[model samples]
Structure formats: structure tokens, C-alpha cells
Target: MAAGGEPVRLIMSGAVVGQELAAEFGPLPPAMLPVGVQKLYELQLEALGGTRQHLVLPEGYGLTDYDRERLARAGVEVAPIPEGLRLGEAVVYALNSIGAGEGPVHILHGDTLIAEPPLHADDVIVGARRSNEYAWAEIETDASGRITVLVDTRAGEEGREHQPVAAGYFSFSSGVELLRSLTRMRGDFIAGVNHYAAGRPMRALGGGRWLDFGHLQTFFQSRLAVTTARAFNTVRIDGLTARKSSRDEAKIWAEAHWLQEAPPAVQVYCARLLGFGAEAGRSFYETEYEYLPVLSELFVHGALARQPWLRILASCEAFLRTCAQLSGGGSGDAALKALAADKTAARLEAFARETGFDIDAALSLEGRPAPSLRAIAERLVPAYDLQSGAADSVCHGDFCFSNILYDSRVRRIRAIDPRGLVGERPTLYGDVRYDLAKLAHSIVGRYDQIIAGRCRAERRGADFSIAFEPIACQPWLEAALGEMNVRGVRGRSVPVQAVTVSLFLSMIPLHADKPERQMAFIANALRLFLELDSQ
Candidate 1:
């Protein structure tokens, strides 16, 4: 609640660094991405008591319907800043458009978050941080910790090692008073504030933790910090700022240090819990049959890397062996029957037509209708028919590259986030070939490529490769193929490459929200199936 006892929260959404963030990460606006369980904007707003919300967005950053709906659900009314307007103009425009009433307007920068926020009813409160960087406006507070003046740190000035800088957080008792002040506001918000702050009582609350997500380095560091704090409940801080890669390395070092010297109770409880979980998981395999499922290591020894083909093949072999115990390994179950029952054909066609990827562009199925995809899916999916029968087993239903963490330094691969039971199936087990195909989707389908910023790839029939220009992916593809331990197709293709293509089709419905990813999965599945068909 504000000083007037009415609820109002104003959040500035578009950052000047949004384009840079998109280039580094995906196209998600900074407000939308995860910071622990909450989004960056969600964390900021949560600090303020729930109220009528005003979100300021820049026109350059495209707002999707999903983004708009999400913001609405979060109790926000979005005001898009025209492309030509500056940040100051945008803020003012948003404030006016949202009709911020006579109550206090809780204004916060979308790019920064405070571990301990100092916000109150009436007086102006600015979060001050002790920083070595001189890029920000400096805050000089009086003996009583009252902000006397904010120094504008000019560019090319040498940075002081320990200095106080203003972290952007503001609360105004009167929206009318703030609006009057903002009319004369310059691009520099703090400097502009000094004009209005003359003789006004203001407090400089200082704390050790402050994250400014304006830069890519700070953004990732903030993510790492919040995630670790959520997971381990504490972060060992070596220093505040560094360049990007070394900064993450420093955080990893801090994590390693804490792991060594953390409280024994913490470590012991973690161990006991993991032990119990592992025992319970193993019991399922032991009681059901002799096959061991994909096991995750309780500890990760090094940085997470991509799944190694060797570990993937080994896991598949074990899963396949387990399925060999069942009657007719490739026999279709109810789930498989339902999936292969032709409902997805229109969905595939609609996706293809929308994305400009032709499903029947296949040589044999040229100019074929949407049912052509359904026909191919029937071939790839497991069934009782001899030609389409898939060698079945207990499968990791949701296996993907993200769940597979490998440590190249330690030469170890750990599987995390196993799908315990899929689709109300009688048992956790399914098709062995599906497991093999899913792994292939990660390796051959280049699922990790788009995420790694090589967003586009080339596909022709069964052949798929990351089409990263100025960098050939042939060697990577060859190496991935070399790791397959299948009976006849090593060094050329996965023996179940056709089966993998089918699995790719099955992956589309799983990513209902990520339409582009779904489209890519659909296109690749069709291409791979066509390659097998031609052969």
C-alpha cells in the first residue's frame, strides 16, 4: 500500500540493452526470463505489494500475444513506447497512459533487483550500492546516511574501487508531484531527480547484494546468483564485478568453495535424501526386472556439457536389453495406437503451411496432402505390423539434451529429470527404439544448435546438420554418427534413423508453446522420413 493506502505499482519494462540480450539469449524480453522460480519482472513487482500495475515497453522489442497475456495475468497494463521516444519519454508516456492516480507510484528499473529492498510509505528511498565501477551515478550521503547529492559519473572517468552508486528504485508519495517533476526530466533519471529532491528528505539504504541486469555479464551473473541462492540457500561472494566468462568461473569457484566448507548438516541431509531417492528408484528396476534405468549422479563434478554419444548409446543398450524381456519388443501399446491414430496430421500440415515448410516436399510424396505426414508417422511409430514394428522397451519418455549433463573433464555423463511415468502407462517402460530416436533428435536433429545460437540448420530427407555459416558442422555430425553402437549403421547413420524421424514427429505436441521449435521438429522429422523412404 502507498502513503494514501491505495495499491499501485509501475514497472519500466524495455531496457536499452534488450537487443544485446536477445542476441545472446533468445528473443525473450528481459522481464520475461527466469530468475529462480520467478521472472525478473515478477521478482521486482513482488517486492512491491500487489496493486494496479503499469508496464512500460519499447516498440522495438516486439510484444507477442503470449507476452501481453502473461503481463495481464500478472496484473499489468502494458504501455508501448513509440520507437522514436527515449527512455525518459517512454516512462512519462507510460505513467500518463496508465493514469497513475494520486497514490504513490512504485517505480523500479526492470534491469535491476535488490536482495534487500528498502521501500516505505512517504519519503524518497534510493537503493545505494558500494561499487568499484564508475559507469553509474555516484551517491554521496551525509553522516546520518541521508543522500546529499548524486554525482553524475562522466564517461572516461577512472573508477574508484569502493564508491557508492545509486541503484534504480524510486517511490513517490504523490503521482501528481512525480508527473510535474517528470515533465522536466532529462534522459538521466538520477540527475533529473536532484532537481526535485532539493530539501526533500531522502534515505540511502546500502546493502551488499545488488544485481543490475543492464549488461550481458551482469544478467548471467544475476541468473547464476539467484538460481544458486534458491538451490543452496547461500552464495559465497568473491567480488561484485568482472568480465562475462571469468565472472561465471568465479561464481563456480564460489560454489566449489561452499561445497567444501558448507555446514555438515546441509551436506548430510542432501546425501540422505539422494540416497533414499536412488534406493527407491533402483527398487522399481529390481522388483520389475533386471534392467537398471538411466541413473543421475548425486554430484556434478564439472561444468555441464552436451550429451556424449558414447553415454547415450550405453544407456540405450541397457534400456533395449530391458525391453527384450517383454513380449514382442516392437508391439504397439494403447498410447502408441492413440498417437498414431491420425489426429496429428492436420496439426502437422497447419504447422508446415504456416511455417512455409512443405511436408510432402518429399520425393515420393511430392504434392501429397496432409495425410502424407500421417502415413509417414505410421511407418515411424511402433505398431503390430511387421514393416512398422518398433523394437520396444522401457523408454525415457521425455529424454532430451537438456536433461543429459556431461562433464568432459571428469569423463562422466549423468542423466537428470527422468520421466517416471508417461501418459498413465501401466509401467514406466515403453519403446527402446523411441529412447534411441529421442537421443538421436538431440545429436542428429541439432536440438541444441538453435539454443546455442546456431538457430538455423539444413535438412534434406534423412540427413540433418547444423547450418552454421563460416563454421562447418560436418565433422560434428561425423563424430556424432561414429558414437552409435547400432548393429549395421555406425559411421553413416543411426540404425534407427528412420525411427528417430518418427520420434521427432512425436516431439511436436510436447512443445505447444514453443511454436518455432515445434515447426523445426516437424520439418526435420518429415525430411528424415523422406530420406529413408527414398532409400
Candidate 2:
């Protein structure tokens, strides 16, 4: 109702099949009309903040038989009309006819849910509206103070003027004259207003957030957008920080108390224990503590040293022969078979038990089944043959980046991680290409870091003869063959390394994890295998 004492009546129209609209009028003449009018009248009196002087005409009513019965019980005045008339149009006609001479009539859509009482008659209220070049549907305004419109340009060719403006909402003056004038417009009432106002200046009221439950995609997108926004806000409110102060402190302490040099007697003792001859033992001991002097001469001075390949093969053969001799093995061929069949598991178990270490657990984590000690010995036999077939020379048992120290000034390579022992036969040997290949592969894989940068042959002074190189890995087949030679074990090339690389590539989806490198490695291995099989 207007504050100046003019009577105000709310005219609700449109298909009212649902009880949503009629249910709002309590204890007053039912908007649908019949018995419940008393209760509806009371509701209207309470809602409008006035008495029963105003007449309520809710026209354009469309309700199911059941709903009609309920409306009749509520004492609503039902308007009689042809069954097929468009409900929206009929409602407009009814409101204009009934409220023509009234002080002012406010027409509201029945489908719009109003959470609060109607505004004062003089104050205009707006809902949501979307605008296109040809037509606009008014919608609720947003807080940004912008009139948003859902513009559809698809019909511009059909003589529909399209413009981008928020649609689905509008407001007009509640003056009796203005109401009569609006009611006189003939065409689709909503479209008439939009068309009439196309070029005129109208006060624009902004819209708020709104949801149209008309489509599934819109529903889902609304939910997702809201959820994402909330999550982002939460993360912003509660940030994260790193925690490694204790570790950093420990590292600092260790560095500060580090020893500059080791005792002279320690070298002699290590050499003797390692079974190296006096001079070789001394060299090994000195090299272990600092390999710069030796590496510098080899890499920088280009010292005439034995080829790395020959050394690798020779060392492998030597290790196998020494094991066979210790076990009272008769011949190479016989030893190989025996070693393969030997109960190495029990030996490895015994060693672990004696040392109080969990070798099985550690190896399992590396994706390698713990092989028996005898199986290990047998694997070494093929390596012995490869060594003997290649050449006899001093082999760096652990030929890897960490084991070979570098002197930047001299640019030499020196073998630091050495296993000194004599072999009874000429061992397989070649250039250092394979070692370099393994190193390259290792660095890329970051496997060394995972293994804690420990020497493959010595962990807590325990002798384990597996070595890894960071960078400079050989071709798959050659590396496999070299490994077989070093282990003194022979078997048909199984494509194990290639398969492993493929598995790794597949397991990691991130491109930065080296998918291409792994793929290339697999391809090369497959090519080599196919060629070998053909031969």
C-alpha cells in the first residue's frame, strides 16, 4: 500500500496449478476462492499491514482438480473463462478489468517466490531480467550494480533486434493511470513492454545472484562454480609452510665437525682386509679417501690406462673364478651349473641374520627379488666368461660416477671404489663406454638418490657387488651383456631393462618425469632384441 493512504491490491496472474501462490494468502478470501477465505483474509491483512478494504483478484488461475478443490475450501473467487486461453494472457486481461478504477494495482507473477512482504506501492521493485538485441527477459540484479543480460544473437536475421542486457526483470510505476495505460497494450504483454521501452529512457535497477532451474548443464555448472570458489577461499585463508629446521641443523653440525684426513694405518688395514697386494693395497686405501690425484692424471693428463671395458669384464671374471675356487669348484662349465643350483637364499639369509640387517626388505623395495647366494654366484659365471673373452686388465669393480672422482683442475678420472683381488683367468674387458652409459641412465632415473647415494659394493662395510652409474649408460643390450659378464652369469637376453623402462614410463603420467626418454630406451632395446633374434 502507498504511504499517502491510496489503497493497494496485489494482482497475481499466470498458471497457478501449484499451491505455491494461493497458499500465501492466509485467513482472507482465498485467491483461488471458496471456503478458506476467512483464513486467507487474515493472512492478507497481516501481510499488507492493513484491514479488509482492498479486494484481491488473482486472475489467470490454472489449477488441477485436486488443487481446485483445495482452493474452493480456501474461499477463493474463481474466475470463469474458456479452457484453452493462454493463462498468462488471461491473467493480464482479468487484472486490467478488475483493478481498472482502483487506487493502484501491483501485478506479480505467481511463479516468483517472494521471501518478504511487498514493497510500498510508490517504490518500484525489480527482479531478474536478461536482454538480447531483439528481446530481453528480466532477471534479478547482481551486487556489482550491473544490469546483466543473456543475449542471443541467433535470431538477428529474423528481424529481432538483439542487445546485450540482463533480462527477466522489470518494474513500472504503480500509478493508476500508468497501470491502465500498460494494460491497454494488445500483444504479448511482456514483449509489448520490452518493445515499447526499447528506445525510451527507463530507470534501471540492478540484479542479484539468481539460478534458473530450467536445464541440467546450468544446474551442474552452478554447483561446480560455487564449490570451487568456496574451496579456493578456504585455501587462501589457511596457507602452508615448510618444516625441516631440525634436518638443516643436523647437517650444519655434521659439516662443522668433519675430519680433514684419515689415519695412515687405516689405509694399510683396509688394503689388507680388502686382499690387495701391499702397493695396490696402499693405492686402494689412499684412493678411497681421496681419488682426485689418480682421476686427475687419467682424465686430465690422459694417462695410458687400460680401457674401461676390458677392466670391467676382467674384474667380473676374476670375482667369479675366486668364488668358484673357494667353493672347491672343478671347471668353469661345471661351476656355472653348480652355482646356479646352489642354495644362495640360505646363504644370503645367514649373512643378513649374522649382520642383523633386513636384506630381503631392502631388495624387495628395489623391485628385485632377493636371489639366493648360489644363484648370485651362478649369475657371476657368465660375467667371468665375458671378462675372459674380452681382455685382462685392472677393472674398477664399481665403475660409476661416485666411485670415479674428478679433479676439475687436471680433469682426470681415478678409480676410488675398488675391489682388489686376483682372478685365475683372462676376463672380458672393453672401453669405458658401458660404464658411461650406465651413469647417464642412472643420473636421469635419479635412482642413486633413492638408494641414498651409498656404494653398491659397500653399505655399512658390508660387501655387496652391485654398482650403478649416473649418466653415460650404454645401449640396453650392451649394458645387459656387460652386467651379465660382470656377474659371471649368462642367460638369453630377456628385454628386462626395456620392459622395466616401459613400465616406468607408463606408471608416471607427468611429462617432466621423462616419458620420452623411457620410450626411446624401450624402442632401442626392442630394436636390438629383434635384430639379435633374427640373427
User: Model 2 reaches what TM-score against the true structure?
Assistant: 0.25
Give the TM-score (vs. native) of candidate 1: 0.49
> CA lDDT, every prediction?
0.49, 0.30
Query: In candidate 1, where is summed lDDT lowest over 10 consecutive residues?
Result: 284-293
For model 1, residues 247-333, the per-residue Cα lDDT tens digits are 223333332332233234322211111111112212211011101111111010111123443444454444334433443343534
How many clashes does each candidate structure show, in the order listed?
7, 114
Error at 81, model 2, angstroms: 5.1
Residue 40 Cα positional deviation in candidate 1, in Å, after optimal superposition: 2.3
Per-residue lDDT tens digits for candidate 2, residues 1-535, read 4433543344343333233212211111123221111112233333344321223233343343543444455444444433334533554455555543534444433222222333443333344433222333433223553333322333243323222233222333433444434455542555444433443223344334432211222222222222211111111111121111122223222211111111232122111121111231121111122312121112211212234433433443343333222222223333222222222234444545544544333221123233322333333334323223322222222343334433333333333333221122222221122232233323323333222222122222222223332222233324444355433323123222222222222222222244333233223222222333344
Question: How far is 392's C-alpha from truth in model 1 (Å)?
Answer: 18
